[model samples]
Target: MELQTITIKREDYVSIVEINHPPANTLSSQTITELREAFQILKDDIDTHAIIVTGAGRFFVAGADIKEFTEAFGDYDAAFAMAEAGQALCDEIEQMKKPVIAAINGAALGGGLELSMACHLRLAAEDAVLGLPELNLGLIPAFGGTQRLRKLVDMPTALEMILSSKQVKGKEAAEIGLVQAAVKGDELMDTALTLANSLVAGKSMTSVKRALECVVQGADEALEHGLERERVKFAELFLTDDAKEGITAFVEKRKPDFKHQ
Candidate 1:
């Protein structure tokens, strides 16, 4: 499909999706639609074991396109649709079988930060800024940000960040568990790639996908239910060829060749 706002590149088993919108890289409706399409394609791409998302210039994504908000003003249904669209895209990214990593090279505010939060992993540049500043615009985060931020950090921290419209640097974000790691600007992409590779290299994608499902899909469920789901998945994995090979390799003391079955 033709994409105007994003570019997809392949590096071996990894797919790097870069937001190419200039200026602020704001998430206009067109940009969001293109992103959904790109990710949908990558989700089924067997060659792409993992994915990394980043932006083109100084801004990862400044925020959603405030200009578009004007079109929805005074129309509750239109506003609701906009919010639902953003939430659906985030939910899709969060539930992907293949891992998705956010390489935050620059500012990630409002919808940008929300998008990063939905990824399986996030690595931000030391100077990168991240926050949900929707409140500052007389609005609130409508893209699962409120829920994910609370789960990532403490409730109090999330409340404070949202209420105060506070933007934290990457280092502070890592300290609060908003991001996995913070590296220098020049090292952000390299660090993200290293992390993405480490997560899938020499590992069974079957196991990786199940583990992600247990964590992401079960996060909102009761502890008992989550454990039950994990147990069921664990037993189910044993029936797969990759799982059998992995166990045998453990006994043979050698790396198992995984076909990702």
Candidate 2:
């Protein structure tokens, strides 16, 4: 499919998706729609075992397009609809079955940070900076940032960052658990692809989906409920051919060939 706001390229088992809006890579409503469409195609592609989301030029995503924001949010209902759409997009990313990694190459501010937070994993260039600076615009992050950031870090740190509109560099973000790792700017995509390749190497897509579901969904539920779901998934996977092969291979002392059955 042709997409104006983003570009997609396939490499090995990974879909390299780059947010392609020029210098800033702002997320206008149309950009969000394109993102949803792009992901839909990626999700349906059987060969796409993992995905890496990055940005073109200098910014991962600067923020929402203020021009689009002012135009769409001319009234209360429009504002509500816009916020709902943005939040729903983030939620979709959070729940996506295929592993999605955000390679933050530069600034990931406001909605950009929200999008990165939704990914299953994040790897940042050492020079990258991330934050939710919506307060500076007299607004709060409407794309699940308040919730996801809280889940990712301590409440105190979340509050301090959000309230102060503070931005942190990649290394500090990794140290605080916001990103999985930090690499040099030139090596960011390579590092992300390496991580993606590792995940796809010997893992069943079904197992990957269920495992992600357990963590992402469980994060929103009570501890007991989450544990119950995890137990159910654990027992259920044993019935799959992949699981059986895994066990047989372990017993035989050979590498398992998983067909994602």
Candidate 3:
């Protein structure tokens, strides 16, 4: 399928996903639908071991395409559906089996930051800024921002960012655990791909996926529960073709060619 708002490319074990609804790349309803479909396609493809999500140009995504909502929001249900559908798009990335890395190369505000937060890991560029500035617009983050933000960072930090409508730099994002690494602008995609390659070659990607799932799905839970959750996934991995190939390669002390299946 052809997409004007997103670009998809796959080479070897990685898939590069880019949001390209240009001029700030606002998330229009159409863009939301397209994004959901794009994510579904990539997530269903077993050959795609990892995905690197980034924007086409400068900004990752400003937020919801307010211009599209200005007139349609005359009804409350209309507004709710818009937010809910968008949230589902982001939610799919979290549920996907493979790893997803967010290459935050520029501004990632409101829904944009929410999108990045959905990824398994985030790497921000030095110039990247992320925040939930929805309150300033007389609205709060309606697209999983309120929940996901707090889920990612501490409650206090999430509230501080939300209430103040403040934008945080890459350094601040990394320090607060919102992002794992911060690097030069040009290195954002490269860093993400490098991380993806490392996971692809480690012969423990199923373990990595298990760990990510345990933490992301654990909720306000205890370590024992989290460990148990991970244990289940780890055991389940042994049922897949990836487990057979990866474990055999490890026993042979050779590189595993993961099909991500």
Residue pairs in collision within model 2:
none
Query: 128-173, model 2: which lDDT tens digit per residue?
Result: 9999999998889998899989989999999999999999999999
Best by TM-score: 1
* Predictions in order: lDDT: 0.94, 0.92, 0.84
How far out, in Å, is residue 48 in model 1?
0.8
On TM-score, who's better, 1 or 3? 1
Mark the 10 consecutive residues where model 1 has the least summed lDDT: 213-222
lDDT, candidate 3, residue 41? 91
Model 1's lDDT to the true fold?
A: 0.94
Model 2 ranges with Cα > 4 A deviation: 72-74
Q: How many residue pairs clash in each candidate?
A: 0, 0, 0
Q: Against the true structure, what is each candidate's TM-score? A: 0.98, 0.96, 0.89
Superposed Cα deviation of residue 2, candidate 2 (Å): 2.7
Residue 136 CA error for candidate 1 (Å)?
Answer: 1.6
